[model samples]
Target: MAKTSWHELPRGVRDAVQRELGGVAGVEMISEGLSSDVTFVAETGLGRLFVKGARLDDDLKARQLRREISINPYVTHLSPEIRLQVEEAEWLIVGFDYVEGRRADYSPLSPDIPLVLDLLGELSETPCPEIPLRDAGRLRESHARPEDLHRFSGDALAHTDLNPGNFRITSDGRAYLVDWARYSRGAPWIDATAFAMCLMTCGHTPYDAEGIMAALPVWKTLEPGDLDAVAYYQSAMRSAWQPRLDPWTNASVAAARRWFDYRVGLEVGL
Candidate 1:
């Protein structure tokens, strides 16, 4: 998606940001993420802020923006704080306190692995706030067995997308999970499972990924068949959703299949 430049935004939107931040000194556009039409960091008189938004006319993006804004309060401790919000007839923009960090590396030997696991441990213990969030099983409802969907139910709040880019590792080894657009209410192990998938994508085999995830407390509470059910559901979901011809989607599908097959092999004592 081509990012809309700072000047391309409506005058009303620009004015709102300037006024809210006191004054804007400079603007740096961020081009990595595809969810936002306008994403940039504004150097303001107050401070630098990470601003992201989409036009109100784009229903999907608009809803995602609103959902992200609504979930900010609940996740502020582990994520950035929402510093400003601009809602006009044509646009909805949100600004978060700029976080200085590097993208987390999920490779097999990266030291960032432990920091990521610790973040997940904290996230698993976070209480699910009372807000409208999608149920985790909805992603697998069309593919999972009817009897197994209940296994995904729990009061825990999970960041369902555990992609490495979504994690920010600070210089001091603190890990911050950003981008709550896909957050959902689900069992505590949902995050651990997602992290395992991410590890697999970064060259960790299924057994190695599971071994890494074992450090998280949530990964220890699974019943006899929980891992099998999650792996099966994740594989089914990944296979069903890889319509886009992209490297990321292709890699994810292959990784999920590997995980599901590994679980199945374990079941048969292979």
Candidate 2:
């Protein structure tokens, strides 16, 4: 989606942002994330802050924004600190302490792999905050068979989207996961499996990705045939996304199928 420029905002909304930031010296629009209509890094008199917003009337984006705000406190240690949020002229905008980091590399031998896995290990054990979060099964219902949904059942707070773009690696070797709009309550292993899918996309084989994750406690708790069920669920999701033809969807479908095929081979003792 094309990003909305800082100048494109209504004067009142811009004023609200400026007031919240004390004063803005410069603004750089960010185009990576899809949920926000306006995403930018503003150089304010106080400091640079990453900000994003959408029209209040867009129910989907509005809800996603709200979810991010609500989840921020709970996941602060794993994400940038939220510093500003204001609603004006029908637009709701939010700001966060600008993070100094690069997009995470999920390649087979990237040192980032360990940092990301360690972050996921912490996330798997982090208790779910008392907030309304969709159940993992329900979130995947349209793309997965009902019988297999049971495999995703649990109370662990899962970051459903594990795309490399959602991870940031700092110069000091710290890793952070961003975009909590789709976080769900699910089996602790869900995020690890999602990470494995991303690893495969970056050239790791199914066995290698799963083997690396095996060091996490979540992986050790998987019941027999659990991974096969996850594979089936993921393959079904790929089929559902096939018609989209978007680059992300296409790449994800291809990666998902590789793991799915490997699981099928395991089932047949190939």
Candidate 3:
């Protein structure tokens, strides 16, 4: 593989992998997550494999690498194939059988919206064996404020970043959610709301409040108090970050800020 700077990788961690996994025939950096880097294909003597890399210094990234390897065995038959785990100096490397898929586009919002929602539901319902619930306190320390904790609801594995680019749509129409570094235990609605926020940010206004309502019917099942908790949690989360996200992701964050302020009746703007 050709040596490249870290920033050249879409996910920003491929340089570390190439340095450690030498003689890699081919390398394609795929997605950069909040904490980890992903490559669509990495060449090994045997064959090409999907690889993800992260620094051990990032607690979340390190934990997620371990989680992917641990949970992968149980879900291999149920979901995608997780191949192996290789530890390279200062970096955790994970390999998976390459799944053929393409990024979903934002045009024709009708089907994609519901499709992503269904994908999240399926992932959340998958049988995870004995993984600890994500520490809400730790997340609060990383991104939330004190008031955010009071709004905590039930916990489940949430794909915190669900922007359109993060989803891969196979030719068979199966949707795979990649980039697991931000995977955390949180209210299920957080993912739904985050998805909704992304859609709106991408200029797909065809789905309005009613569309968000329809996709996440779980909100209706919640008691009035529970609904309040979900709203606060989502609002606080929507406002939690101001860092430099991927170029495509910035619009989504701005839209989320607008929606959050509108809902909470606060002037907080991104």
Q: What is the C-alpha lDDT of each candidate?
A: 0.88, 0.87, 0.58
**Model 3 TM:** 0.69
User: Who wins the lDDT comparison?
Assistant: 1
Model 1 regions more than 4 Å off? 243-245
Question: For residues 1-270, could you state the per-residue lDDT of candidate 3 as single tens digits?
Answer: 332233454342444445545546876765544445444467865467777666677787688778767656544533467655656556677777777777766554456555666676676576435676575446655445554554444565566767666687777777777655455666555566566666667765523742664556544444444333434445555456566656655665566555554555532332
Query: Evaluated with TM-score, which candidate comes out highest?
Result: 1
**Model 1 lDDT tens row, 1-270:** 688988999888899888999999999999977888899998987698889988999998989889899899988889999989899759899999898999999988999999988888888878899998888777668877787888887778988988988999999889999999998988888888888988888889999999888877888877788889988987998888837877667888889999999999999999
The better candidate by TM-score, 1 or 2, is: 1
- Model 1's TM-score against the true structure: 0.96
Q: What residue pairs are clashing in model 1?
A: none
> Please, what are the lDDT tens digits per residue for candidate 2 over residues 1-270?
677799999999988888878999999888877899899999986598999998899999989999999999999888888899999999999998888899999887899999998998889878998998889877778777677888788889988888888888899999988888888898889898888888887888899989998988888878898888888888887867636756667777888898899999988999
Q: Which regions in candidate 3 have their CA more than 4 angstroms from the true location?
A: 1-40, 43-47, 55-61, 74-79, 88-90, 107-110, 141-151, 205-210, 225-246, 264-270
